[model samples]
Target: MFKKLVVGTLATGIVLTGGIGSASASTEGVENTKQVAPIAQKIKLETNYSSTNNQYGFTYTWDSNRQVYKTYDFYRHDGVFASYFESEGIKWYFKGKVRDLPGGGALGHYEGKK
Candidate 1:
């Protein structure tokens, strides 16, 4: 009976320890997502017309201090639109669309991470 009690206690302790570790990992993941959301939200691109290709495109760079992305250039093209920028030893790229906004300006969507 004593041996059985010891084995059961050990098993329960192991399971509880694992559960605590998993909870901690989950919390860390949530915090990371929260941090990344703001960075991603700050990305913006300005629209430009390319007379050559007759398509619209945009270019931008990441501003770490201001937490905003600055547009550098834009052009029109076919196929997927892509642009590259480097910040703090990390290389990032933006890939998405450039479309006309009903009111006036142009809108772009790009995704990248550093």
Candidate 2:
């Protein structure tokens, strides 16, 4: 009976400790919040185009103060008006917001025409 009890306790401990679970089970819910933390920082604009895809772009630098978020703008040959938008995480433009992504696809400072 004592040996059986010991074996039972060992089995329970192993299960509880995830010794017999899949590799992913160990990190089931332990999220890396730090990794998701907003990377707020200044960015250097890099791109040149009149009205084409990949017109204007920027590379953000790590900043100790501030959570970097996406900033959108329209680019036009004439400096009249500009459209603006913002987002965090992947892809500044999402499926839900696809409609909001400007039709003609202007770059840098969106204006009236949508």
Candidate 3:
């Protein structure tokens, strides 16, 4: 479990490094709300754009089923924007901590676009 978490974290970090920074530049519109506790959300996700492993493009179509998959830890640093993922019939974004585990899945805390 620890190994998986570590690997997942590293992978996610790589994904976010270039893609996320270049995507939005800064978490401009996103609020750094660290108060909300992350909830499990197994959102049905689809690729929004084609991205390779290390060279990632953080864009995806996600369902709003708030069950949890892993975590959005990678998204926390730069903060993800609506262009990154779409959910709940509206564009979605995240600026808090999140994570993804092997069997359990992703656990994320997101803030919808205002």
Candidate 4:
């Protein structure tokens, strides 16, 4: 068990160091590295978009009338991205962000803006 754990740790370190070291070479390469490396991403918003929402789009009533808008925003992080949202004249802000842990999995935050 100890041998297995050591081997796994060593392997993970090698891959992370290698990929992260070269992540800035190119955009395509960065994406590939993100897939290989154990990057974390945490999406704050709920993305349960139905077919109707996609087709007709969802509505947000900011004022008495009604309005709706949404968007995706990011600051070009290694493996992190954010989402934006807007409701008619009303504006929204980012919720939370996710950072890569030492273990595995991806956790990201959904950021929003007008």
Candidate 5:
């Protein structure tokens, strides 16, 4: 048992030291490393469309106004409209608590609620 423990410790030390040394050595050319261009931001939506609302398309209903003009709004990250809604002219929009995606998975019914 003692021999095994010692061997294990030695192996771990060797691995750790090798990793650290290699990492340090790799930094030797840091000054000559090419500057990487900023990666384009990508938005990944786990789910799109509202199941309960039976709505399609990217737009959503902002408000219901007695069968008049329904208000609509859109959700955008960095000015890109990811989601939107349509409703009466009342101009409805998602609240602060609304989830980024539709359906009740993230925020439950609260996401569909006004």
Candidate 6:
């Protein structure tokens, strides 16, 4: 019957379109993983230093093999106030506040990728 044939054709179209959409989405995820994989897997801290005054300082370095740049900043009143890095078409950021404790100490909380 024409109705049966039409129903079958519509079902076939829907299935084909769904399959194509899923395939494309999977491919896109793979591409994104590849783009960010280098930085996520290979980045490492190279050097870190603090200021003599302890008010402000920073660590700077790069992953030579992966070509990722990284830096971490330190603050006397605010421990590890901010951090930033980028590589392989991806960028990462971290920021928080920390209070310097009494008697030359620090007390605070921070959260982010380090």
What's the TM-score of each model vs. the native?
0.22, 0.18, 0.21, 0.18, 0.24, 0.22
User: What digit string (tens of lDDT, one per residue) describes model 4 on residues 3-63?
Assistant: 9999999889879778656655556445455556567897455443222123324322222
Cα lDDT of model 6 by residue, 37-89, tens digit: 43456656555332221222334345444454444333345343335544334
List runs of model 1 lying over 4 Å from the truth: 1-61, 65-73, 83-90, 100-114
Model 2: ten consecutive residues of lowest lDDT: 90-99
Question: Native-vs-model 3 lDDT?
Answer: 0.46
- Model 5 C-alpha lDDT per residue in residues 1-114, reported as the tens digit of each score: 999999999889889787645655455656757777788988653333332233422333322332322213333443333233443222333444334454322321112333
Q: Model 3, 51: alpha-carbon shift in Å?
A: 31
lDDT of 2 by residue, 1-114 (tens): 999999999999888877865434355576683477678998765442233334345332322233322233433344333233442332333212212334553334221111
Which regions of candidate 5 are displaced past 4 Å?
A: 6-24, 29-34, 44-114
Of the candidates numbered 3 and 5, which has the greater lDDT value?
3
Which ranges of candidate 4 are over 4 A from the true structure? 1-47, 50-92, 101-107, 111-114
Model 1 misses residue 49 by how many Å?
22
List, residue by residue over 46-107, the lDDT tens digit for candidate 3.
43322222322233323345423222333323333333455434334554445654655444
- Kindly give the stretch of ten consecutive residues in candidate 3 with the minimal lDDT sum: 49-58
Ranked by lDDT, the better of candidates 1 and 5 is 1
Q: What does each candidate score in C-alpha RMSD? A: 14.9, 16.6, 28.0, 21.7, 14.7, 13.9
User: What local distance difference test score does each model get?
Assistant: 0.50, 0.41, 0.46, 0.43, 0.41, 0.46
* Candidate 1: count of backbone clashes, pairs at least 3 residues apart or interchain: 2
The backbone clash count of each candidate, in order, is 2, 17, 19, 13, 14, 0
